[model samples]
Target: MNKLISVVAVVVGTAAALPASAQITSGSIAQNKAECQAQFRVSDLNGDNFLTPREISLFRGSMPTELSGREVIHRQDFISACYATLPQDD
Candidate 1:
């Protein structure tokens, strides 16, 4: 009985260690984009193509959330900087 419980606990722990979906397997932009977009869309509280501070806050509030506030802010800052440097969206 003790051995069985230990085995079950290990299995549960290992399963919990896996990601929600195996889709976002790679960190590459192209590969992760679609998955991230899907997640962003579903998670985007304001329905904005871009995430707002509140929306991001809500995202952080939800579940097994990774990435610190600083990380999110830094990522948003970099993205904003890139967009600013872009030629045109039109």
Candidate 2:
């Protein structure tokens, strides 16, 4: 029936669009992570792999206004949350 064919077409079209959207999303995530990693490195002022309280405070102080107030109790958590506020690289 025409209704069945229309449904199939819609489903197929949607499925085809999904991968493209996913690629875009993943790419943005990757870029965000890269930026956060750079920030983390800069924040690790002592050259240690870990972020100490002083480093965290300094980093938080320098963070953009939007990200300045987020909980940054741990390195991973801080980086992950930074993704939300870090601008996507062109």
Candidate 3:
């Protein structure tokens, strides 16, 4: 009886923890693309095709650590990074 109870408890605990660790989707590719484009357009103040480090800093409070070494950000690169930072759905 004790062994059966322990098994059931373990199974229940595992099931309960699954949802907590699940990865939430950011959004569809189209949605993310649109959002990223809009963000880039607004941040590209100089009408240049690429974003300077200063522009990026002003747009986002601070650039992500992964982009620390980048001197310039192209449209596609900016979009990809924007998509990556999107909030995950609960």
Residue range 1-83, candidate 1, lDDT tens digits: 99658645643454345455523212222123333443344334334455556545545542122344442333344344324
lDDT of 2: 0.51
1 or 2: which has the higher lDDT? 2
Candidate 2: 10-residue stretch with minimal lDDT = 21-30
TM-scores for all candidates: the values are: 0.31, 0.41, 0.47
Best by lDDT: 3
CA deviation > 4 Å runs, candidate 3 = 1-31, 62-65, 87-90
lDDT of 1 at 3: 69
Worst 10 residues of 1 by lDDT: 22-31
Better candidate number, 1 or 3, judged by lDDT: 3
TM-score of structure candidate 1 = 0.31
Identify the superior model by TM-score, candidate 1 or candidate 2.
2
In terms of TM-score, which candidate is stronger, 2 or 3? Answer: 3
- Model 2 spans > 4 angstroms off: 1-31, 47-49, 64-72, 87-90
- Cα shift from native, residue 59, model 1 (Å): 1.1
Comparing 1 with 3 on TM-score, the higher-scoring candidate is 3
